[model samples]
Target: MVLDPSRYQDHRTWKMTPGLLRARQPYFRNNMIGLAILAGVTAGIYSYTYRFLHKDNDFADVPIPPIDEKELEQLKKEYEQHKNERQ
Candidate 1:
């Protein structure tokens, strides 16, 4: 069935005016406050989870193997000889 255009004409007649905006100010403010609260809660949860997951990680005691000075010197000498040959 075809709907009468005249019946829906009232829906299109509404225009955004300063007075209308002023009337809806409280609604917009409430929505913004709610969105901010949700974002803050999400960030707080993520921060807490990240800290909790990484709290036990300690790398200070990890022993680094000592480098042999003789082996390093030999490698350096070989590299210098190769460089001199290339030039």
Candidate 2:
């Protein structure tokens, strides 16, 4: 069951074998890996943006609407009358 050590002795020479010369030469860059990295970055940025925008609740800077107290009272009376008529 002993294996020959001579077969694997020339490890560097295996890359220069004549028939497999094409495999030894460097090839073009892979687009899928680059695209996957870009997608991951974009998703991370979008997630951060969503979290940033939704994190605030107390919007104190915005101006409140000028509501008239008399008009609100009249509206309430009208609503009550409408409800009574309906019943």
Candidate 3:
């Protein structure tokens, strides 16, 4: 819906706080620093949560073994022992 700008706004504005809001708008844009901080915090939280939930699944090719690689090495050692015993 298109709003009539003339009904809500005027060039002559009496601002109580600088950078607080557009002329005639009730919403305030004051404390831009706080808004930025909140946005950054939200984004950081979301990113952290999303990564924690999905990192391993998404990065299937990641070289880091998800489980103990020692199991494989133990199996190999066992096989080698058995082969040596046989020979």
Candidate 4:
């Protein structure tokens, strides 16, 4: 037996439907929290990948202290005496 669409159409009321009632209520549509989370995760992944890619090289920029001339001369003298003693 086939069902008649016209008989059910007359009994269907838009005012009593749960879907229509829920659609009329205000909803929280702001996605700022989700966006911030995504941004943080993306930044963390990018920074880690960049660090891994440059791990083998000395990329850190640090200041060097001045070397003393006396220390250099003393090291040279010690090396010369050791070499002479070995011969």
Which candidate number has the best lDDT?
1
Error of 4 at 47 (Å): 0.3
For candidate 3, write residues 33-76 as lDDT tens digits: 67999999999999999989876666677798565788989989
Q: What is the lDDT of candidate 3?
A: 0.69
Candidate 4, residues 1-87: lDDT per residue as tens digits?
Answer: 354334324344423355544664444244666788899999999999999988866745766778799988998999999999999
Ranking by TM-score: 1, 2, 3, 4
Worst 10 residues of 1 by lDDT: 3-12
Better of 1 and 4 by TM-score: 1
Residue-wise lDDT of candidate 2 within 1-87, one digit each (tens)? 354334434455543444344553444245666888999999999999999989887877889888799989999999999999999
Per-residue alpha-carbon lDDT of candidate 1 for residues 1-87, written as tens digits (9 for 90 to 100): 464334324445544555666778889988999999999999999999999988876876899788899988998999999999999
Lowest lDDT block of 10, candidate 3: 15-24
Model 1, 43: alpha-carbon shift in Å? Answer: 2.6
Q: Note each model's CA RMSD in angstroms.
A: 7.9, 14.1, 14.1, 16.5
Candidate 4 residue spans exceeding 4 A from truth:
1-30, 57-87
List the candidate numbers ranked by lDDT, top first: 1, 2, 4, 3
Best by TM-score: 1
